[model samples]
Target: MGLSVENSVTQSHTRTHKTFLITNYMLLGAASACIFLTLSLRLLPSLCGFFLILLHVVTIASAVSGCSIVTSGSNKSYAAHMVAMVLTSIFQGSVSVLILTRTSDFLGYLKSYVREEEGETILKLAGGLCVAVFCLEWVVLGLAFVLRYYAFVEGQSAHPRNERVSEEELKNWPWPFQV
Candidate 1:
């Protein structure tokens, strides 16, 4: 009877922790997505740029939180989602710097002087890179959302008391749950 009580308490604690951890992950993913969108839309007024920068900061924080969860071995799908967030954050940060610094203008001038055709090619290449990164991020976001959905579904069902897992379970969760 004592063992059963202990097990029940443990299960309850585990369930609470799992939900809390999941909440953190979802929020992180959401914040990362918000940053990506805001930064991508930055234009015109420098104030927008400032907002983008702020968003980037938030993205980094989200990435960190995601990383912590991944390291904790909470859920593989969640880990994978965090990895995506980290990658997106790094790419966004670099891209933001490039855009804000007029790096493109400098590169364009250099290309134009050396080879007009080549300069146009370089411009196209840069644009293509941006598009690719943005598209990839969108894909990641979609995957994250889908994964989160699956997680929600899985958690929606109550587990039999006797079957409570001691170690975190990543089985068939979805997406990058086992990352």
Candidate 2:
């Protein structure tokens, strides 16, 4: 049997964890939709970019909440979620670093293509917004992994391992792998 935290431990953390995932996925879906809106509504690409970054800010905040929740030991599924977050954290961290490293290159690229009078301003504003969000996203996702590790270790030590696998149950699976 796995470690079990007493119900008295409080479930606020699990509630918050679920809330973050729900909000993150919903806002991310909307952001994906907004990106498509740029194809048809052509007042300004920069305006669309700004809103896109705003939506992402919400998503990243949700990620931070998820990270915090992982540290609280409120949910059993935290391990699974953190396992997934590890992959996303790596990807997001790389993206954030790339943006930071290439910010100047990005501004130059913008100057080369965007001839609008305010292109540089938009570049600074919108790119700064995106880079900031990416940076925060990287931080939280990495923290989530660390938090999950501690929770896992703490949980393992807290609960009693009373349940044992029966011979019949063991025989049902391949010898080396039993649930």
Candidate 3:
């Protein structure tokens, strides 16, 4: 009987620890991807880059919300998710102004290198795509908010930490497959 109890407790702790790690990994991946995409914006035209930038913004917001939800309790999750969504919406939406300004300033240069009508159409389409992306992000953020709120209100707390790693100890974490 003692052995069985010990086994069960061990299994429970393992599961809790694994869940925490997975959630943390997800948030970190999202944030990293956003930063990478944001830095690559210079490779594309202003309009196209603007659309990509919005995607990065959405990814960053999602990452922040996910990290908050995983680390804090449900109440904090809802608050964090809401805040990230609002900030992303405002910042992402306004970023179109930069796109417009940049494109306008560079119009003459672009015209000299390409056909005017074709370039105009491409620019228009790119602008349209930017708007579409922003709208989609807004909708997704709303759904995430709702889901987070539902989860929070249900008293569903994640498993307790099974072990502790001091901040200083993190420096010794093994590289992938090295441990």
In terms of lDDT, which candidate is strongest?
3
**Sequence-dependent TM-score of model 3:** 0.40
TM per candidate comes to 0.33, 0.39, 0.40
Q: Which stretches of candidate 1 lie over 4 Å from their true place?
A: 1-104, 108-116, 158-179
Determine which window of 10 residues in candidate 2 has minimal summed lDDT. Answer: 34-43
**Number of clashes in model 3?**
0
The models' CA-based lDDT, in order, is: 0.50, 0.48, 0.51
Ranking of predictions according to lDDT:
3, 1, 2
lDDT (tens digit, per residue) of candidate 2 on 13-129:
455445545544543543344334322223234553344444444454455456446666466556555554455444434434544566555444323344443444444444344
Q: Candidate 1: what lDDT? A: 0.50
- lDDT tens digits by residue: candidate 1, 41-82: 333245534544464465546545543443343577576656
Give residue 99's lDDT in candidate 3 (0 to 100). 45
Q: How many clashing residue pairs appear in each of the predictions shown? A: 6, 0, 0
Q: What is the C-alpha RMSD of each candidate to the true structure, in Å?
A: 15.4, 9.5, 14.3
